[model samples]
Target: MSRFVDIRIDPAIVRRAARGDARAHEIIYRAFSAPVYSIGLRFTRVPAHAEDLTQETFVEVMRSIGSFRGEAPLGSWIRRIAISKALMLLRSAWQSRGQQLDEGWEDFTPQRGQDGNAAPDATIDLDSALAQLPPVGRTVVWLHDVEGFTHREIAALMGKTESFSKSQLSRAYQRLRPMLQVDEEELADSKTTAGTVLGSC
Candidate 1:
């Protein structure tokens, strides 16, 4: 799961939610919505899909609350559901489109404003950079880097060998390297410009 979620919920709240308490349901929704939506967007890069995933994830959470065994942290379990939902949509996309990799992410690269700071197109965010890779590669990177899923786990999720996960991650990094280099150079330029301005002042 992303660091954006703080997963520490009172177990009593789970009990209440399981008992069909509306307030408890709302509590769980508020706590988990951001991370769920974030995961959706990171995976699909589409606002509508992310919104739908968020809604669907909550519905699943409510329906399954009774069986949640507390063997894992609530957040971890919720994240698993969100990832599964996102993958299902992606799988459908793959089947429909013949695994067409979205090149739209190419529209976004590192751009800077005149103020020597990140411009409207600033591309330092991993999500933006990640858009450069193929869908499976993107999924592998996000799950590993942000969500902390091991390669073996990711491979199982994708129904591939562990080496396939490793290879995708490797390929993703390769594709992202030049963009990251540009980002680094831009940061260096920004700092140098700032220093020059300060010295003149």
Candidate 2:
């Protein structure tokens, strides 16, 4: 999925966009909007804030399209803009609380799955599980795993050290492992039960 999003677009369309062709601009916007908004939501965990960031990202994209060399995929360029805008919002919010961004990590306990059951394995919802993570943890996991950003890239985006991104990703995986293991065990049990029933029949 990440590879698909990072696929290169036609240079002609980009040139047309850089020249202020409205149709070309719209095409680019329509193609990249979902992924951009997804990054926003994953980072902010708020639909409204995500929408605002998406708009801001596109605005920046349009303004800077003239300078967009074909060195990288247009989607990659837009993703950087989206990440920058989202990080700006996060930084502002943290500052408003008179808090330092380098503060210690807070302990995160995985919440029950959407089914209100202790065994999250019964209902394996990746998005639900990801959403349950704290903002910093969720951003690290999504950027590293979903968006295919390197730990160093993520650290630069978050204005933290590479070690911070690595540590946060490690913590997120630690919390997610048990929840995912439960689902694997459940699948094995179901297959065994099915085999036994067939044998009895």
Clashing pairs in 1: none
- lDDT (10s digit) by residue, model 1, range 119-185: 4442445445566566777787777765667889987877778898787766666565555545444
- TM per candidate: 0.76, 0.78
Worst 10 residues of 1 by lDDT: 192-201
* Cα error of candidate 2 at position 162, Å: 1.0
**Span of ten consecutive residues with least summed lDDT in model 2:** 192-201
lDDT, residue 16, model 2: 98
Model 1 misplacement above 4 A? 100-125, 182-201
lDDT of 2 at 82: 87
